[model samples]
Target: MKFNQYIFLLFSLFFLMSNSYAEINIKKCKANQGDYIIFDEYDSQIAEKIIDYKLHNQPEKRENSIIKIFANENSDDRNYWLASIQTDNKAEDYLFYQVDQNKFTEVDQQQFQILLPKIVECNQIKEVPIYSENFDAD
Candidate 1:
């Protein structure tokens, strides 16, 4: 390659490398003990079947709330850097975006979905709900 072409290629590689992006775990969405990810945007219709999510007029609160940590990315397309579904949210979810992450009160249409639900507590005596899809016999 010519000297100028070589320089151009080197510059391009440097430019690409300079841009930082969030590290994502490609594992299929599941519960984690600590902070995990929520890569996919919300789909309300699909969520209704697999897990019991936010229901209108009835605030859902359990002993534990499911959460995921979204590292800030360098893309203009996505604004949410963090998303959460607390038991105290009163059936509504929240999205924390890049602009004012600590202050945002409402979830946007682009907010990440709760793809993985962390099972918290099972208090029923002697009987497990075998009807649950997530139930594991082992």
Candidate 2:
């Protein structure tokens, strides 16, 4: 009986070690000028960085306010990253970056909206709409 218990414990430890290694080997997205947002399997925030850029001919520099990271998908060649970022006070934006091509572009708004629900679902965000009702006599 004691020998059987020992064998079970050893197998459990081996399985846990293998699973931990698998999670550790997941490929993470690499950012160039700005940093990419990373999240864990439980939808907990991991790492994030904000970037600042100035508009052409504008003196004021704006900070890229990233509220949340919706999703990140790697390209077939593993040289590009397609991600959706929710900006402060604005709709979610889709971004594509190619490492080899050295290209970065914002995808269309229509496509971004279409993917919003999927992103929210994957991120396990509980979205709730709030409505305010006002009753005033003038």
Top TM-score: which candidate number?
2
lDDT of 1 by residue, 1-138 (tens): 699999999999998865433332222222233342233433222233122333232323333444333422222223323344445444536443333232333443332343112111111211222122222431
Q: Estimate each model's TM-score.
A: 0.24, 0.29
Where does candidate 1 have its weakest 10-residue lDDT segment?
A: 117-126
Mind sharing the TM-score for model 2?
0.29
* Alpha-carbon shift of residue 111 in model 2 (angstroms): 3.7
6-40 in candidate 2: lDDT tens per residue? Answer: 99999999998665521111134422222333324
Look at candidate 1 and give me any clashing residue pairs: none
Candidate 2, residue 83: the lDDT equals 47
* Model 2: CA > 4 A from native: 1-64, 67-77, 112-138
For candidate 2, the per-residue lDDT at 58 reads 26
